[model samples]
Target chain A: SQQGEEDPQALSIQEGENATMNCSYKTSINNLQWYRQNSGRGLVHLILIRSNEREKHSGRLRVTLDTSKKSSSLLITASRAADTASYFCARTSGTYKYIFGTGTRLKVLA
Target chain B: EPEVTQTPSHQVTQMGQEVILRCVPISNHLYFYWYRQILGQKVEFLVSFYNNEISEKSEIFDDQFSVERPDGSNFTLKIRSTKLEDSAMYFCASSEQALLGEKLFFGSGTQLSVL
Candidate 1:
């Protein structure tokens, strides 16, 4: 079964605007990681937030984890046309398996 | 930077036939994994391996699936008997350590088309 579900199956924004994607999970997780996948390609790890950490940042990527709510969010600041891709949240639960969400397709217009 | 690599970017096979997908994980990484994504669907975890053995697997990983680390650098997933439903993009990933929050390096993936 999938552990996480992402909201807003699709989003479109102009370059320089911020894009926010939300993820909700069912079970207790050790960590949650966000990934981006271009069409016809594999996923690229963007950022990872541990259960113990509330928020983390890397370049334009900001990930926040709220263990109390069993949810996480990924915010891409000043999005660029190159950032357009499918965003997915993967949760690592008690098992080693990392369950992925349905994903959000983000399209940034040039 | 070392990255995961997969072979046969695209493969076409007939149902009931066997197929093998190969991957080479990042150097010095200790953990490896295989995932599949159907068209317009979420990526699904198939299996995770550590220390040359499967550490975990999802229900989608049935008897038809098998993973092996035949050599020091190569990891492979074999489908004993392919089915049309098995057609999807198969991705291989690897992590440097077993930490809970480490990032996974993924390969470009192989598009498996089981006709």
Candidate 2:
């Protein structure tokens, strides 16, 4: 079974607008990480938030984690067409394995 | 910056044939992992290797699947018999164990097409 599942399988926004995607997981995790994938490519690590941390940011990417709710959200501010890609949330279980969500496809229109 | 690298960016094999996918992890990393993603599906963990042995593996890694670090730099995943359902993008990742929070760096991936 999948441990995490992302909401709104897909999202589209104009450049400069913000894009928000949510993910919900089923099990307790030590940490959560978000990744981006261009079409037909490998994943690129974006941000990671430990269970103890409520929020984290890197450049235009911001991630928030609410362990109580078993959910997390990733926000990309001032989106650009180059930012168009598929986003995935990966939850690290105690077993040292990461289970990834089905992912949300984001398209930033210029 | 160091990066994980995989060979034969794409591979094609016939059903029942053997296939080997290779990966070269970052020189300083101590942990190696393999993941696969079927088209339109989530990335799935197949196996993790440490100290020349498998640390963990998922059910998807059946008897037919095997992993080996033949030398210091090359990690290989071998499938005894290919199946059409096995076609997917295989990614290799590595991380430093000494680092408190291990952040995996992944390779570009090898697209395997089983026909």
Q: Pick the candidate with the highest DockQ.
A: 1
C-alpha lDDT of residue B25 in model 2: 95
DockQ values per model: 0.78, 0.62
Question: Cα deviation in Å at residue B97, candidate 1?
Answer: 1.2
Winning model by lDDT:
1
For each candidate in turn, give its C-alpha RMSD to the true structure in angstroms: 1.1, 1.2
Candidate-wise lDDT, in order: 0.92, 0.91
| Model 2 per-residue lDDT at B20 | 97
- lDDT by residue (B60-101, candidate 1, tens digit) is 899999999999999999999999999999999999998766
The regions of model 2 sitting more than 4 angstroms off are B98-101
TM-score of chain B of each: 0.98, 0.96
TM-score per model over all chains: 0.96, 0.97
